[model samples]
Target: MVGALIIALGILSAGWLLLKALSRGQTADFTAIRLALARYLALALEFQLGADILSTAISPTWEQLGKLGAIAIIRTALNYFLSREMRDERGQTSAEKPVVERAD
Candidate 1:
């Protein structure tokens, strides 16, 4: 539950960063990063919610461990995706333009 909230906060922070990027005219790259972050955040929320449902439905069984495995896998994937999104955000840098060649 706490992890899910952290992921949500990350998504919100990424959104704010993306807004800053867009205001600086970095629409193309920022869009990609923003989408990635949003995706991971949503996935993390879904994973937690589903795990809660699973536990509610099943007290204990061999399937409990299997559900736990699924939860871990989903969380891992979300973490990887979030990492990639952060990298993408950092990559959206404003490149310094080369000075115009001085004509003779």
Candidate 2:
């Protein structure tokens, strides 16, 4: 239940950000918005994994354990890629910024 709620919140927050960006009249900082959404999704995935763990703990069937393992692997992969992408984007953004040289 809590996991679902958190996921729902993430979805709503991302949707709001998208709408806000769209309202900016073609001048929206889309990269920032995408980063924010990715962060939310990654967080939501964590909560979901926790929920799955809890659920499996209550019923230790082999089938349930297998499913949980698969889910965990998939979610972990997703989080890893998301983090990598975010890091790359941040690096790119920083590299694109103009660095001012100090005047002696």
Candidate 3:
């Protein structure tokens, strides 16, 4: 129940942020928005994985174990890609910024 709530909250928050960004019209930085959504989704996935683990702990059936394993693998892959994308985005943003040289 808690996990579902967390996931819902994450989705709602991401949608709100996206809508807010869209309302900004031409001045909105989409890269930043994407980063924010990715972060929220990653967090939500973590909570979901935790919930699955808890469920498996309570009942150790073969079917349940297989389901958990598949879920874990999928979530882990998603998380890994999300994190990599976030890192790349951060690096790209930083690189795009103009660095001012200090005058002696």
Q: What do the candidate models score in CA lDDT, each in turn?
A: 0.67, 0.84, 0.84
* lDDT (tens digit, per residue) of candidate 1 on 1-104: 75477577777878788788878987755555566566667666666757666675667666777777776687667667766765665555433334588889
Error of 3 at 82 (Å): 0.6
Cα RMSD for predicted model 3: 2.4
lDDT tens digits, residue span 1-104, model 2: 66667667767887887787678775535677778778877887898899899989997899999999999999999999999999999898889889999999
Alpha-carbon TM-score of each model against the true structure? 0.45, 0.80, 0.79
Cα RMSD (angstroms) for every candidate in the order listed? 7.0, 2.4, 2.4
Ten-residue segment with the worst summed lDDT in candidate 2?
Answer: 25-34
> What is the C-alpha local distance difference test score of candidate 2?
0.84
**Order of the predicted models by TM-score, top scorer first:** 2, 3, 1
lDDT of 3: 0.84
Question: Mind sharing the TM-score for model 3?
Answer: 0.79
Better of 1 and 3 by lDDT: 3
**Which is better, 1 or 3, measured by TM-score?**
3
Instruction: Report clash pairs, candidate 2.
Output: none
Per-residue lDDT for 1-104 in model 3, tens only?
66567667767876787788677763446787678767877887898899899989996899999999999999999999999999999999999989999999
